[model samples]
Target: MDPADVLNVRFHYGGEFIRIGPSLDYVGGDTAMSVLERDKLSLPELKGFLADHLTVKDSMKIYFLMPGRQLVNGLLFLHTDEGCMQMSEHITDAGVADIYVEYNGEQDEPEEDASGSDFEDELDDLMDNDDEPDAVITAEEEDIVQGNVQAVNAVPEQDILEHILVPNEGGVVTEIISSPVKHNIRVDALSQGSLPRLSRF
Candidate 1:
């Protein structure tokens, strides 16, 4: 049989703690797997690597859902073959198989109504509702928006900016504005350089 065709399987590792859920990723290959009882890594040379892990005394072999042809789409190919080995070992150790698997239960999908009653009711409600969203805003909010352009142009020099925005509580938050005097002086200096005799402010 094709390896990929083997979809479901049981695995075992001598340990407590069992975890089972929908596989978030794919695994396969060989490494320190308790199933094969080997410390060194080796890809399961044969399916018996899987069967022994499940602890099947008789012909009751474990089944495994092998990687499908579209391994890329399934996001399984990236996993090292050893990754799968480790995963199976982990799941079996977690008592994933002991929990019991109940088959024949399928999720029911939402069904649409044959009549248009639900659609008509929704349409009528829409027609009856005349409320529009409110346009409430504060004057301070307007000032922030209208002043944003001016504020952006007022970016301070690297040193002063760094001092103002020092890290607090082990995290950094940008300081929007530094000392008013320093800011003004910087702005003035950029616009007008030092003169021979300038009046002190």
Candidate 2:
């Protein structure tokens, strides 16, 4: 009776996932893992067995996936040897075991270049900038408008002459020319019918 007949084990290490089926009859089978967790397997032997599937260098790290997404690292030799079966039971239902993998690249890479970017520089400058050119133009326009008003107001006043109306026998109205020094007109010598009365409009 072998424990390998009762378990389907899966491991994730060295950027590769290794699945060891219960029997070689399945798609992927590990004859090496079949010998693991037995009383005959040792620490060096397990590491060497893993080396055939993964890069097992000096200071290599190994972690087991536990229940509720917890992780237990292989720190102690004896404890790590036993943790394989214990941790494997937590990941799969009944007798099967597997681990989850994810890439957290987005959350880690943005922290470095966010502050010094061109967009941030432009935004900061826009937020901090201030000045009003329209107000300055309005002030200058007001000064020119005031100067034009003042010039119009300073114009001297001139006397306006009022024309006097004279009535004649011909039933026509005419203006008396009193200011102009000119030749006298012989109105008494002319016939009354020949006298012009109405002024040209």
Candidate 3:
């Protein structure tokens, strides 16, 4: 395993978030980045940097560490400026996140259609309710939601700290939910971001 072999690279076994990509002027070419470098860049930039260095950007995927030291699929970075989330904000200075480089080619076979199309269509119809008027919401609804969110959305400082602590891995745990369930369990609300809508009302 020569260090120059970019197709099959793995970073050091540290950090809560194990970054799977190639080295970008960090570490001794074994890991993707150093602790200081990981802290300097925001999470989005770190992802972008990885994509920029890859020959197979399309196959690249990102993962973030969650509560209880679990790795889960992260937001896909379509563009460099998708969001302004800082790595330091979530990861601590002493935290050690590693990056692994590997081959990520597209699937050879095309995706097959699911067998539950009819059932899915029926569910969609029930949920969409197209017959309902599009302009159902009034200014009053927006005002109430905005007021409620602003007043009650502040996450407790300690609770926030709790979310960032991964069990065995290193790096800072800046933000996350209390749950350890994988991406399969996330709904639109929890998946959206921190401070998910507490209520639909």
Candidate 4:
């Protein structure tokens, strides 16, 4: 298949990941889809590769890697009697180029000096050490700051979805699957108050 016709989807698992370039030639098929990588493998073959290499279990974290390497979090795979698997419809609908999976035993440790308490202390110290001691906070300045904060806090849930759904300049949004399973994935992500910012993606 032509490289232009393939959609590159990356699978990140436990510090190791594989990029599978599935052909956009067909929509839904029980048969395997073509892939482009170092060792070319089909969609089903790639799934089998993940099953064998990554530890599949319940409670695993899944994320869609957006453009510019931004990770939109809170996507989780369904764990059935067979194994953990993301709905095939969801995959095709998102038209995602990358998928990050945090399986059991593949959790990343926090970076050194990156704990929440340490961050808070650092911020507090910075605020306390004002470069200009004579600087006074005018009423207008206070109002502006408060207004900005309120605007951020008052952002509607649909706004977040719009931010993700709307295509950027010269970019096209792939058709998304409107199944309940896929809808729930997005809803859950929104509920967490951690939607990806427009500027970031």
RMSD of each: 26.1, 21.4, 38.9, 38.9
TM-score, model 3 to reference: 0.25
lDDT tens digits by residue: candidate 3, 55-165: 334454443332134233432222332222332234433444334433344323446656459888778778888576567768999999898877645644334332323
The estimated TM-scores of all candidates read 0.16, 0.27, 0.25, 0.24
lDDT string, candidate 2, 37-128, tens digits: 44434446555656666445555444444444323332222236466545534433345344322212211123465567999988887778
Per-candidate count of clashing residue pairs (backbone under 3 Å): 16, 0, 12, 0
Each prediction's whole-model lDDT (CA): 0.39, 0.44, 0.40, 0.47
- Model 4: per-residue Cα lDDT over 1-201, one tens digit each: 555443445565554233336321112212122233423434444455445545454455544443443232334332341222232323443354454555445454556754469778888888989686687889999999999989866866455443335454778654332333333447666687644443423
Best by lDDT: 4
Candidate 4 Cα errors over 4 Å, as ranges: 15-46, 72-96, 104-201
Give the lowest summed-lDDT range of ten residues in model 2. Answer: 100-109
Q: Where does candidate 3 stray beyond 4 Å?
A: 1-31, 35-44, 51-56, 72-86, 98-104, 107-201
- Candidate 3 global lDDT: 0.40
**Residue lDDT tens for model 1, 60-130:** 22223333322223322212457445434533322321111111222223577655699888878877899
**Which window of ten consecutive residues has the lowest lDDT sum in model 1?**
96-105
